[model samples]
Target chain A: MNQIAQEVQHQTHTRLSEVSTEDLIVDIHGLKKYYGDVKAVDGIDLQIPRGTIFGFLGPNGAGKTTTISALITLAKPTAGSGTVVGFDLHDRNNIKKHIGAVFQEQTLDEELTGLQNLKFHAEMYFLPKPVAEQRIEDLTKMVGIHDRLSDKVMNYSGGMRRRLEIARGLMTDPEILFLDEPTIGLDPQSRANILQKIKEMNEEKGLTIFITTHDMEEAESLCDQVCIIDQGKIIVQGTVDELKNSLGNDFVIINFNSPDEMNLAMNLLNDLPEVNEVKSSGSVLHIGTKSGSTAVVKILNTLKEKVEVNSVEIKKPTLNDVFLYYTGKELRDDVADLSDRLKMVGRKKGRRGMMRRR
Target chain B: MYASTSKSQDSYNGFGIFTFIRSIWTVYKRQNARLINSKSQLISIMIMPLLWLVIIGQSFNNLLGSSNPLFSGNVNYITYMTPGIFVMITMFSSLFGIISLFYDRDSGYLKNYLLAPISNTAIIFGYAMGIYTRVFIQVLLILVIAIAIGANIPITVGSLTAIILFPVVVSFFLSGLAITLASRASNVETFQAIIMPISMPLMFLSPILYPIKALPDYLQWIAQINPLSMGVEGLRFVLLGKIYTDGAIIDIAQFNDHLAIFNFALLFLVGIVFLIMGSKTFLNSLYK
Candidate 1:
């Protein structure tokens, strides 16, 4: 009995040590939030592992911001709880010490110089002046804003302000950083620069980033794992390659001699059990199935026996298709519509109220 | 690698009470810097009140003169109006505290403070202290002008202490009220709508321009109940050696002792309650 107990204890210790290495930096369980009658976030469960770049993708009104707000202790969750860096979200005072956030809006003081802005934040986190100064210098250099540190933020361009905002988020040297649509309205070059800095932060410092965006290209290039949410619920989540592979084998598209021949080709190709979906548009017959090369060779050989084949192409699935397959709609469709109502209603109500009061 | 680890460890020495206090002090210093930087605005804020003291005080002299019977032995209207004007300055300065808060919230700068590791209590107290500092300077300037204009304030040190404490107490009272209003305000318009009624009524009902005893029983009850009345009366007792009475002139010496203790306790309790409620509301409204 003594010998058996000793062996079990050794195994448990080894397992515990391994588990510590894989501990999640952010663990959210069954979190929910409601805005009056609208359920903004309904029961979201997510686990972001330490030292990984995680992207949260969702269409408008999909509760992405609500989830981020809950995680950062900005908004209270109506149900369930989440932990950031092993600190409870409900216990805001403790959780605030470990997490840094850049909000959707520009949260910096526009009237203050960049250096002063950083200094104020640093002081709030209680870093000594010398330490904060050094960190600020390093952060400015990292974000490529070191040259404009003395200029007031009001004088800076949108891109410059965003870069400074990112640097401000890093002032506390957080283990987990949350960036909500960090590159929303920037020009292409500025967006690319900001994305590169985020990548470098993850690579060099081993920092865990939880970034939310609807930009498919950004998630494909930057995130190690991506979760797609729609209608206040997470539909699917996995690495980019895993999600794409889950769509099932590659596809082969063959352009026929005529539009009439395309339907005939699709009809013939449907007989093959390996073929998943065969769609014909105009003179093109698009076939999605396993073993693309073999299917293409067989289809070409069969087509030669009947009609002519003009061109053949094989392409891999992309993140765009993955998004469409999960959400049943294009990601970009009517996203700005959510904010459009707010702009119209908020302004009209505000104006009418003001006039009546006056 | 060594440098990086050291930096990371240093960053984790998170904020405590002392650090929070230091941060508030830094914010207070910055507010003063901005006030001083705007030379014209600073001069105007100081001059406008002195202007009121001279012009309005002189214009209302007949209405406030001893022939009115309410004035009795106190003939000078400037001295009578000085404390009221001082209270007005205090009201204006404290009201700025809430306006600054609303501006910060609208412009999104408040988000940075909200996300910081500091506690909500720290933010409320810091802002209150900062506003009180401005009120302190304004009160001092008014005191100097009052002395120069022949409004006699007792030269004794105890009387000076009471005069100074008067503004601080009024500041605490108004700061609490301002923060409470600021926390509930969704926008500047909403805030203005809410504060105007409260501030206007409180100003008129208080014993600022007139002594409480001169009013009828019902109005006298309202004036006596007003928090501003306690402050204005306390200031009068300290400066002019006057006693507050409802029917007859009470002993000046005994009235001073009673008013001092009562005002101090009331202001302190109100300040604490306002700070707690304001902080709680402010934290809840942070994300919404």
Candidate 2:
């Protein structure tokens, strides 16, 4: 019994030391990247704990990719001091060996087979031949690409290519993996598959993952911590529940046939003491409240005589509502219309900043 | 199954000289693999020199007899132009290999190299050396074709060594220029638009097709400073036992040995300069 206890204690100590005493895998203070007159990634601070999925959530042109590029040493920061895996930002080689990256764009060699691509990356990280071969086999199996490893990457489907890239990213068995829009062009099924593989990698290997995405559902479901960023700055950072509860615990969604009715409903809902926040996009009205049951009762009573409700939903708060609550604009890919819509939203509220950090 | 942290760290070492050479070797392998896999491209590259030897060499030989005022040696027209074709092969093979760079960039594959823990110098060296290897093979093929076609080239050890070593210097120079040009080009179209015109001028103004004397006096100066001309003349000196001097073809015995050494030295100097510049440009693009 004593020998068993000592063995268990030694195993625990070995695992803890292997993982490292440093809790933060990525810690950056005042990171910035600029392109001529444009401030692509304005000053921002981030701390990501090890063995967690931390999401940088933003819209298009929101500097999420730029920030990732800076952190990965693909782009040098304009002014900042930071460490990745306890090494300084300028110590790129050390940091690179410790981290893996799946870029927003496809970075796989189309001319090479999937196995060749993985081997090339393995060589870059200086993996021993046998170790590289074993890891390649293991990682391909984990990512469900074991069958396709012999095929050229060009012949792989879009989802298959993403899976191969994910496997390549893990060739080095990095402590932290940085994925920039890992599922941008993939189909819904592929996205789900990729997300599942990412989760498996994290859980099985105890890997820290930093993912940059504009996907609300992805961030909400996959991330342990998330930061909403816009215009090169982080608007807010917290866990999904913390961000959702910051706005409110419950939400009431209403869709109207006409913008006039939605505006009327918005005005009435804004006057309610039970409503924490109200926003309208097109003919839809979203209301944030403490109690979905009570708010729905008050909302129905207030809108009964004045406005005709098309459809209504009472639900818990999501990252979507949290984003709208803070940004005052909907999360969208159309950057051209985003600024114009933002201006109109700002004008409607008579507020200076469309999105403000709390 | 993953190893524990201590074992993993012991297994992976991103620093030190071995990893540096390993990174370069990996990049070099990728380039050669791509080169070998593209059958159509290889066929085209191999056929280009033969076409030049057949059409151009045959037409010039038939148009001008075996003996002409342009011929300062006992060599025939085909023999006279063979060295030029060899240098041209080196130039074309070197420049053509850079198209892969543009392709890699457009396909976003270059980002993988950039994100690797390797230094930029290793990437540049590995890529340049890969092109040199390609040029070496093409030059060897040209040598065989030149000899088979009855070009009166000497089969001396010194001449063969020159043939092997000179293309490396020429490729070093041309690939450097090509990569420097490619670094600033936004896409393949822009790169081709700029490179085609530059390569055409280099081909015409050099001593590849004709002796420097064949050009007008004003153009001779351009040919004089042209690295391609220097490369061709230097190869012509060792291969045909003749070198062009002051717009006149002369026997290698009459040519100043210092001038011959200067020609190679200048090519080496220019190659080193452009390679350094190209590396800087490539690094700038990464940071930017």
Candidate 3:
């Protein structure tokens, strides 16, 4: 962690000691939303602390968007309950006043100038004219779009439009901001720039941000906490370090010359005192263990006698590796299935063959 | 808690009727801005009425003779067709307003209004008001064009009021019909496909291009019941104080108030019914 991140962590620890239910900006339990027999968002729970960036990581149609719609009052829940920003879930207007959302799609009016879009949002929220004007100016400058405020949105580049959307979301000085794939299609540089701005917003303003993204790297680099959801259920959630640590502290892979040798080495490693589990693919064997530097020597000593190992390398667990360990599938592989299920949900909701996310 | 750094959460008084009106007004302003920005579309719509008054009016005047017994003394065909043209403008304006709804839907901008704190009724009312303003503007332009083309339209205070307010009511009813169709359509193509056939028949079946008495008996009955026909007759009464129907010139005051109050009441009632139906369907399409 960097110095400021460590300082933020220190503050987080101190606040956790005195944290009450009110400290959770978003608190929900057993939330469910069903379309006919399809449980688009099945039973799920979340308790996100204030001033932390939380990532809801999931593949498309894994209920990330559905859950957001339910919380933001775009969809009605079939069961369970929740509270957001000290208001009940059904208190939609009050909750909307305290929370802002940037949808996955670009929802800005292309014909309107960037400034007009921000002012219109303020009008919808009933912000006083003078207060709205000041915030609009401040937020545009913060997102670095103040100079282009007079240009129509259609004339904006994709990154500039995304920044303006973020600025608009902050126009009401909302307590919590919800971003659905905030940087999904931006270039690498733009993506990094937006992520930096998101982190800065969370740190400087103590804004509780709830983000959902399919990008694991974004979650790993930017989120203070993340939850992996699949098939409408949360598989795992924790701090980045904790989730990685949960999948064993180290991974040691051994490459053998033959399948016979790989099986023999896997069997030998199973009996070793330091190794936890051995998984084999092709001619290579992956061994999970703790204190990998020290354990590597002992594992090699045990294997050197019975097996002919071609090469051995030690690896650290990443968020992707943890996702694989928990979900038993690659994140990108399920995208094809996402569309079929989304269509089914749309049809069940009586939509006229349009793929409306909510 | 992070409340220390958080902005103060002002106590929210729940939305009242005034809040509802405010939201509608804001949406109205937004629609007006969009309409103003698209100058080409505005000019294109204005040209349609000009064509009707100049080309269609003169051609029919030659075909049907310059002096016809069906019209009041010395009144030409163009003067009689002007009110019908205004009704046509109102119909087109109201229906075209919902085309923007489809664009809003495709562009995802509709979600901004849908997710806003305002009720669906407010949004519908706002769109209706916007369409009304467009229809009013187009009618005024057509009136200027007609007068410039030598159509004799009387300009009394009552007639001026009717010209301004009558089209607003007619557009309200048509706007509701348009919204009802838009709520069920999945895309712009389907909406245009469905609206074209319905709109063409309504226009031809009404008395926009010719007198209703000239149609066959069954067609005349159909034209008489058309909402556009009611609007045209009311406008004709206010603008001319009489109408040429059934080969006779009947004064509205002597012929009972059916030309003014009766038709206005009918149009108002129809507008309310369609507004209710349209808003309900549109709201249903929005929510799960």
Looking at candidate 2, what is the lDDT of residue B37?
Answer: 66
Clashing pairs in 2: none
After superposition, candidate 2 runs with Cα above 4 Å error: A1-21, A252-288, A293-312, A335-358, B4-19, B67-73, B242-248, B251-262
- TM-score (C-alpha, index-matched) for candidate 1: 0.84
Kindly indicate the candidate among 1 and 3 with the higher DockQ: 3
Candidate 3 regions exceeding 4 Å error are A1-18, A255-271, A297-312, A333-358, B1-12, B65-67, B242-255
- Location of the lowest summed lDDT over 10 successive residues in candidate 1 chain B: B243-252
Model 1 bad stretches (over 4 Å): A1-22, A34-37, A88-91, A249-258, A268-275, A281-285, A289-315, A333-358, B1-20, B26-44, B62-75, B144-150, B153-160, B213-217, B242-254, B285-288
TM-score ranking, high to low:
3, 2, 1
Going through the candidates in order, their DockQ values are 0.40, 0.51, 0.41
Choose the strongest candidate by DockQ.
Answer: 2
Candidate 1, B132-223: lDDT as tens digits: 77777777787788778766555689767766777777887787787777677877777777777778868877767766666678877777
Tens digits of lDDT, candidate 3, B225-269: 788877877777667764343325432224346547888888988
* Per-residue error (Å), model 1, residue B213: 4.9
Please give the range of 10 consecutive residues that has the lowest summed lDDT in model 2 chain A. Answer: A349-358
Taking all chains together, each candidate's TM-score versus the true structure is 0.84, 0.85, 0.88
Per-residue C-alpha lDDT of model 3 across residues A33-137, encoded as one tens digit per residue = 888988888898877899999999887778999998888888877876779888998887777777888998889987789988988887776777777788888
Model 3: docking quality category: acceptable
Can you write out model 1's per-residue Cα lDDT over A1-358, one digit (the tens) per residue? 1333334334434433464524878877898999898999988777788888999998877898899888988888898766788977688877787788988777877656898889878877777777788888889998999999988886898889999999999888888899999998799999999999999999998889999997998999999888888888877777787677777768898887888888777777788777888877889877998878777777777767777678899877888788887787877748487688578568656744753443
